[model samples]
Target: MSRLFVTGRSGFVGQHLEAALLVLPTADWQLIESARFDLLDPASLDAALAETCPDAVIHLAGQTFVPEAFRDPQRTFEVNLLGTLNLLQALKRRGFSGTFLYVSSGDVYGRVDESDMPIAEHLMVKPRNPYAVSKVSAELLCQQWAYTESWRVMIARPFNHIGSGQNESFLVADMARQLVRIKRGLQAPVLHVGDVDVTRDFLDVRDVVAAYLLLLEKGQRGEVYNLCSGVERRVSELIMDMAHLAGVTVTFKQNPGKFRRAEQRRVVGCSEKIQKQTGWKPHAEFSETLLSVLSDWEVREAH
Candidate 1:
């Protein structure tokens, strides 16, 4: 059996990825989570690596929230940039040689023009936020290690992914949470939102995890791939769809406090590269994904 060491295994995407790996038909894989390893401490990371000695490492642990990164750029840099550096140093010290997948965000392609509607891997990255900056920096760091070491380092830049068990802090989850409350009569029949005019490419978290697995199995060394659905949907349409799924009547109210000054007007991605190479494509229906998220919120709110 091949052992895989995974960071951020308890997080939103990490949890789902773990669940997906558990039910796989092949019994040749074992997942080891880095929950016991602190990214800020190199000694702890070294000890963890020495213990697990995995055949591959998936680096998913990082500062993900944009607004939170803005609030504390230092912590974001410390965790996202310095933390990755420490991981690399520890791997070098252990003379590790295996695949290392770095999970990045589509936010790295910040402020793109409409002409670049379906952003491709060739587009230049212009990160606009602290969180995105940190991710881009880490990507460069991983590339350096890939060049210097014999390890196969790959990066997966996934677009906006949403599904069940996501925290309410995220866009779709917040909408579902509010809709659940409205349906339960616990809150007013109103949904507060921000910048609904903007459009984004939303991929189901399950599909994202599937792409990650395919990338690990077949992706090229020292290459980057975008894991996204090529379809762009407006936020306003998503809100209406969620309300319809929840069978709730709701009126929208613009929340000024929730508005982001640097929000991209439209963000989409082309997955033709990964699809052609890995033979992976998104399979979840839009309505099904929304309904699943709403249903999950309903269950959580009931308790």
Candidate 2:
């Protein structure tokens, strides 16, 4: 059985990836349990590597929350950038030469012009926030390793991926959760929202997992791929769709606190690179994905 080492097992995407790995048909993958290891502690990473001796690794561990990164930039760098370096060093010491997939974010492409509606992988990154900065740093680190080492390393810059179990810090999930509460009579039928006028390219978490799996098998080493739907969707449109699914007439109330200071008014990423290379494209129906998230929140709120 192929031993697959994964980090960030507790995250939303990680959870979905675990579920997918369990039921995959082609390979007998023995997923190394994502034991709680401190990335900042080099010893722990080394010990884990020695213990697992994995054939492949999907690096998803990092400071993911943007606001939290703002609050603690030092810790964010220590984890996202230094933590990656530590892992690579540990792997080198262990003589590990295998496929390593580093999960990056589309946020690295901070702001794009309207002419660049669908941002490609070649676009120069202009990271605005601490979180995005850390990701870019880590991406460079991974690329450097791929260039110098024999290990198969690839990067995936996933755009706004949404699904069940996403943190409420994200606007989409928050709106869906609030709608559920309103439907259950736990709150009034008014939606507290941010800049709903913006547009983004959203890929479902399930599709994201599929792309990762395909990349694991077919992706070229040292290459970076953008995982997105390539469809521009308005935030206001999503809110309306969720409200319709939740069977609630929501009056919108703009909340200043919900807005990001440097929010990109329009953001959409091109998935052509991954599609062309790995033959991976988003397949989930938008409406069906929305309904599933709503249903997931309903269950969570019921308890």
Query: TM-scores of all models?
Result: 0.97, 0.97
Clashes of 1: 0
| TM-score for candidate 2 | 0.97
Give the top-scoring candidate (lDDT): 1
For residue 250, model 2's alpha carbon misses the true position, in angstroms, by 0.4
The alpha-carbon deviation from the true structure for residue 71 of candidate 1, after best TM-score superposition, in angstroms, is 0.9
Q: In order, what lDDT does every prediction score?
A: 0.91, 0.90
lDDT of candidate 1 over 172-207, digit per residue (tens): 999999999998899999899888999999999999
Q: Lowest-lDDT window of 10 residues in candidate 2? A: 27-36
